[model samples]
Structure formats: C-alpha cells, structure tokens
Target: MLIKSVFIILLVGLFCQTSYAKDNCPTRKPVICYWASWAVYRPGQGAHKIENIDPSYCTHIIYTFAGIDMDGKLTSLDNHNDIVNGGYKKIVALKESNPCLKVMLAIGGWNEGSEKYSLLAETEESRKKFAEDVSRLMINYGFDGFDVDWEYPTQRGGIPADKENFVALLRALKERLKPRNRILSIAVSASVAVSKQAYDIEAICREIDFVSLMGYDMQATNATSIHSPLKLESSDPDDRETLDQIVYYYKSQGCPTQKIILGVPAYGRSFTLQNPQNNHVGAAVLGVGREGTFTREAGFLGYNEICDLKRTRSDWRNEYLERNAAVYGSINKLWVSYDDPKTIVAKAQYVLEENLGGMMIWSIDTDDFKGRCGQSAYPLLQAINKGLGNQLPSSFSHVDF
Candidate 1:
C-alpha cells in the first residue's frame, strides 16, 4: 500500500508539471504582427481597416508608424483626421474582443529614414523629451507600448554617434515605460554587415522586451536570388543572407533567445527574367516584375496576390527549393520568391527548437483578409499560430521578460 501511494503521488506531480509547461508556452513565445497604416489607401486593394483584424490571430499587433516631428517628438504619420476619427480608436477597441491582445505604436520605417532618429537620440534632453512624448502618445491613443523602426542607426543619413545614441534612447524610453509596465521593442537589421556596424546589440537588447529582427531583404533588389532563403545554395555568394545564419548571428551576439523574434515577410520579391526559359534560382533579371494587383509595387506581391495568380494564371508555377527550404513562383518572364505554408512551418519549427521568442510578420494588412486565396483568410498567420502551438488549450496573456 505504501509503494502504491508513492507511485500515485509521482504521477500527480508529473501531470502538474506537464500542465504548467503547456500553459506557459504560448504566452512566453509571442506571435507579433505588424499592421501598416498606409494599406487603407492602396488604390485597388481597398481599405484594410483596423476593424478587420482578428485579435486571436496575433499575440501583439504593432501599428506602423508614428513619425518623428522636426523637434524630435512622436506624431502620427497619417492624416490627423484619419488617425483621430478612424485608426486610433478602432485599434484600441480591439482589446474589447481579446483582452490579451497587445497593441504597440511603431515609430519610423524605411521611408522615414534615420536622420530624425539620430537627432532625437543625440542628447540626454532630446532622448528624455522623445521618451516622454512617446509615453504620452501611448497613453493618449491607448497603445500598450512602442516599437522603434529606425531603418539604420549609423548608416543611412544618420550620424556616426547613432550607435551609442540609439542605446541611450532605448534606455530613456525604458525608464519611462517601466513605471507604467509598458513594453518596448526595436526592429533591427538582419544583415551581418549592417547590424554589426549599426547597433550595439547587447546594450540595446538590455533595454527592450524583444528584438524584431528584419530577416527579409537580405538579397538586393537588382539581384536574382531568394530574398529570405533558409539555407544558402551552392551558387550563393554570401551565406549570411540565409535565415539560419542571421538567427545564429544574433544568438552569438549575446541576444537572449527569448528576446529575439524572427521576422517573416508577408510579401514576395519579384524579378523580370532576362530569358523566360532560364527560370531557375540564380538566373539573371532585367529589373522588377509587373506591379501586384493590390499592393501595386513593381517587384512585390502580397500573399493574397500570389495566391490569386496561382489560382487564375495558367503560366504560374509554384516550386519549392529543397536546398533552401523556400518557395518561389514563376509565370511567363516573372519570378517571385516568397514564403509559403511549407516554409512558414519549417521556420516555426526552428523557432521552437531554438527557443526564440516567436515569429513576427512584416505587415498583417498584406495577408488574405478576404479569403480570396481559397485557403481561408490569413493562411500564413494561421500556419505560424499552428506551428507555435498557439492553438493548443492554454491561456495567453501579455508576458514581459
């Protein structure tokens, strides 16, 4: 009887431990999605409003972006009327549906450039003012936190002091937000050359909750190569361009695995083939391909547009490169390199294996919100959720580390 009781107690302890681990997994590994503010105005895409976002699909949604005024203050990038009357309130209202959802306001982006960020981070006074203004903006607009998307700190048109200044700025922001229990995150370059020169990663990581690694665009626009390949092909010149190399680079740089979020593109890079017959991986390209129906970018197509082409265009051929673990589509003289459900699943598995924080999509608005893709709306996002085990029976909440 004594031995049987001891065995029962051991079984109960193991069960409790398993349940606790399961419960903590989703909350600890966040699935952060970015929502671009400009998608509402794309000519043929129609307005993608904040109301359309399904809160359950993402653990956190970053609104891109709020700009920096000349005086180094945070201001809305969109029209004031639209921000006040439409986007701002509707975004905060999402919490009503999913109280676990965290909404963040991202400041600066590729076009915004780094000049203003360099200026703002140059001095203690400027950093303090910027932090205070950001804190106020979050409180006023009901944002849960802030995301700094400085294109490049020391590069671009920024000053040499940007590397140090950026760290100071993060510390200042953290000081203000910590009191309110708010979150702070920064988007950093995934390129080894750029990231090494532009950021003091260890110092910066200490001040923020997570590092949103811009893992896409490793390949140049003029080049005919896979933009976000998981592994380098034999023909590839730079192995650093691969996703595996980028993640390992950050990990080696002293970034805690839990504080690093791998970025996935919701769109693909397209290149016009010099010869339609030579539609292989490293074929030469004349220039950017035709504009997407919705995105309207010459060399870019959102997942929805890609899916539409696959469904309607007979010339469209989807192929997966086993060597790179990436998917690319070809149609006539155009080829697009993008992540499909298969690549997303592989990336999700990598995230779990490495114990990384979670996966982050560039912009949620580019997703197939209308279900026109035939695989259901937000299929890529759904893949990430499934990959991360977010659909498991467990409670998720705003977790800070």
Candidate 2:
C-alpha cells in the first residue's frame, strides 16, 4: 500500500511538470534563436564555437537550409551531405555543450518555399509522405523538430489556391507527428497578406504549436525615415508594427495568444536610390550589389566582409532608427537600409507587450561585430537578447559572458 501511494504521487508530479512545460509561462520559457549555416557557415570560418556561445540567452538553435527534396519535401543534408561544409559539426557541438538548448533543422526559405505546397496539400497521401520524410530527416540527424520557412501560404502571384491548402498541410504535419513528439512551426509574414490570401489563419494557429512572425521588414534598407518602429500609438505616429497590432491580427483570427513568437532581424538590409525621402518607395542600391540577389552575386559585400568593414573601418556607420544605417552616409549620392542599437530596443518591447511566445533571430554569424576576423564576436546578438527582457533559461544561466 505504501509503495502504491508513492508511485501515484510520482506520476502526478510528472504530469504536473509536463503541463507546465507546455504553458506560455512554463517555469523555463524557451527563447528560440536561429542560426543560418548554409549561407554563412564554413569550417573554421567562424571565429567562435559552441563553447564560446552564450547559451543562457538562446534556448533553441535552428540550423537553416537543409534544402527541400525533388518531391517538395523537407530534407536534412547536415549529417548526410559533406558534413564539414556548413559548420554542421560546430552546430552539433553547440548542442552537446549546451544540454538545455534543443536544436532543430530548418528547411526552405523565402525564395524557395511553397511552390508546390498547395498541390501537395491536395492529396492526403502527399501530406503523409511529407510528414514521414520530415520525421526520418529529423530522427536521422538527431534533431528535436522541424521549422517550416514557407515565405507565404497563399498565391505568390503564381497560383491562387494556396490559402486553404496551407492549413491542410499543417494539419497533416500535426497528424503524422502525433505518435512521436516533435515541434512544427510556420514562418508567417507581418503584412496584410495573411488576411488577403484567405489563409485559414485561425486554423493554422489551431494546428501548429506556435506562429513565428517576421516583423522586421516594416522598413527596408535605404530611404529616409523611421523604418521598423516599435511602439506606435497611431495617433502617436511612432512607426512600425505595434504589439497591439500584432496581437489583434493573431487573436482576431483565433490564434492562441501565448503561442506566437515575434522575429527580429539580426542582420539589416541595404539600398540606395534617387529620392531618399520615403522609406518604402523602392530605391537603387549604390553599393556594388543590388537588392533581391545574393550578396556575392550582387557583387557588393558578403556578411563576413560587412562585419570586418564595421570594425576595421571608421567610415562605416549604422543609422539604426533612421532605417538607413547601411547607407548612413552617402559616398556622393545614394541610400542604404539597416538598423543599429536604437531600433533593436523597440523590437524587444514589441515582444513584451503582446506576451508572445519568444524571439528568433536570423543568421547568428552575421551579427558578430568582429566579422570573425577580430576579437570575440560582440554587439549584434547580445543587443537583441538584452532587448527581449533577458528571460534566459536556467539551463544556460551558468554560461559564461
């Protein structure tokens, strides 16, 4: 009788713990931060490693760009493909060093997402196959879950029926992963597009674990004005997406309040155009590169190079609040886009106001102030963490500064 009582108590305790973990204010809230290796990572290329990482601030690490398969499925090329290429081992090493950090592999990005997602969602078989493939991919590489970076759900001006299909696809992902506990999240834009496309926003919110909002692009690079305003009162005319606005969109659509995570960009965009008066009006890039193309292809500068310039060169200046930091100074007559510390403060406040899920940042290496060529990486990422209320998980608390 005594043993039975003890066992029952233990079971109750376990259940309580599980319930808490699922709560918005779980004793240990997970602040998921993403890192892109495919575009910027290379063996020994980064100056830092997992041990050097300040895990206290970031609870999850998402390795982006494993690429989608020929059949429109998400696949992992980290462990299977030339592992040494994209800091795959370094990422694995980060996980080993930080037990509290749950790692996931992200597939698809803005440019290469959801082309056939609608067609795949049409048939149940296709959805099941996609789920099975995702499970295999995660299990094979030892990841906790998958991050779906589908740029937009509905039409990309290419097709008109992706809205409903997007919801069906999430439902299928949830169904297939039911037996096995895994994470599923969708990357959503902060524009009015969600409402326009007829994306079952309420349904998408119901099926997925959390909604990740890309709220950084309110103002692009270049131009002349406040870009990503944080706390605007409408009548206040501050600028950017307000927390209340974000909450209204999700809540109106019936999305769970606590399950939404706001995204803040670790890197900023750059642009230069003729009339640099308005922030949004599409401008010409004065730098070597142009917008919409890869940095290398565009011929201006890549991430690491930019970082080096920020440090080694005094001429480099970032006008964070102006939304023209990357083009802070005109080399003659031109404009650019990017943020500095001033804007990050507002971004963090938005997270607090809505009581959203968490914050996820773009490619970590790009944020390194030193460009991996100088002293320890600084500034960029640390600023973001500081902005988010510094709600670091206990597991990473012991992490060094």
Per-residue CA lDDT of candidate 1, range 313-360, in tens? 887888787656678889889899988777887888888998999999
Runs in model 2 with CA error above 4 Å? 1-29, 40-54, 76-90, 220-227, 231-247, 273-334, 369-378, 391-401
lDDT of 2 by residue, 1-401 (tens): 99999999998988776555434332343466776554443434443344445655566777776666657666555544326453555565565445556677676676565665556666778878887888776676677777777766665533566677777778878886656777888777766545557467788888887777766556534333333334453333434454346557777878887788766665444455454443333444444325322333332333454555565667554543332222232222333344444455555556666677766666554555343645545455555667765654446323332
- Alpha carbon lDDT of residue 68, candidate 1? 86
Stretches off by above 4 angstroms in model 1 are 1-28, 44-46, 238-240, 392-401
Winning candidate number (lDDT): 1
User: Candidate 1: TM-score?
Assistant: 0.89
TM-score for each prediction?
0.89, 0.73
Error of 1 at 223 (Å): 3.6
Clashing pairs in 1: none
lDDT scores in order? 0.82, 0.58
